[model samples]
Target: MCIGVFKKENFEIVNNPKDAEIIIINTCGFIESAKEEAINCILEMAELKQTANCKYLIAMGCLVQRYKDDLIKALPEVDLFLSIDEYDNLWEKVAKLIKVEIKSKNTLDYMDRIISTGNATAYLKIAEGCSNRCTYCAIPYIRGPFVSRKMEDILEEAKKLASSRN
Candidate 1:
């Protein structure tokens, strides 16, 4: 859903900071190692922003969902912070950051205007939010658990994306 709402070719996905302008680091906070990786990514992006004239640095995904306040303060250079729960609002958040209003009543509508990877790939989110009460994990607490997408809805989306691309 998120990937389908951006002009993908407009941004080069790179692990190296030397070749990109905007860096949207989808981070993971599921474990200590993941946290370290996320921090390292932020630091690298910050350096690139300083020396390479990178215009925007956005952090999203699980790391932000887990450490929203800390990430905001620690990486002051980060231009935007998007939590996991905000996956559906990716376009809105990005539009606000770039100061451009993409007129759309729904995410799918917004996706039509935006160019996805422009490739033959797409992600279909079958469900949103998790309801597990695992203590170490924050997803269930933050997202409130899963409500499965109807089989028909999933099939419909898959068929649409596949057929359109084909």
Candidate 2:
């Protein structure tokens, strides 16, 4: 959803993170290792400011939404921390930072993407967030409920993708 929205609005998706001007990390805080990995990745990307052209680093996803306050204090190198709830205002925020007028559609299903796979395959994110509650899980609290897309929208997107592939 993030990549699709960014690409739709004309944001360039660099193959390498070091070459990016604005680095947006869509993280997963599912397991302990995933959380650690996400943090390590953020720290690595944050280093680009010293030697590369990296200007803005946006840390988002489950970790950001769930443990935002902790991350804010732990990682002062991050320019912004965007929780999942703030996705609607992402365009305005990015535009404000880059000093450009907002151009992307905020709707999630639009899914205009830069296909890096070089094939007909595409990932269909049928839902946003999860509602599962485990003994040690933080997904439900962080991601909110598991909200599926409308049947009509899903079908329409499937048809569009199938036709494009053919």
Which candidate's lDDT is highest? 2
After the best TM-score superposition of candidate 1, give how far the Cα of residue 40 lies from its true spot, in angstroms.
Answer: 1.0
TM-score of 2: 0.85
- Find the number of clashing residue pairs for candidate 2: 0
C-alpha RMSD values across all candidates: 4.2, 2.4
Model 2 steric clash pairs: none
Structure candidate 1, residue pairs in collision: 129-145, 130-145, 131-145
Candidate 1 to native Cα RMSD, angstroms: 4.2
Let me know the TM-score candidate 1 reaches against the reference structure.
0.72
lDDT of each: 0.73, 0.78
Per-residue lDDT for 56 in model 2? 88
Each candidate structure's TM-score, on Cα atoms with residue i matched to residue i, is 0.72, 0.85
> What lDDT does model 2 reach?
0.78
Model 1: residues with Cα > 4 Å off, grouped in runs: 8-17, 105-124, 160-166
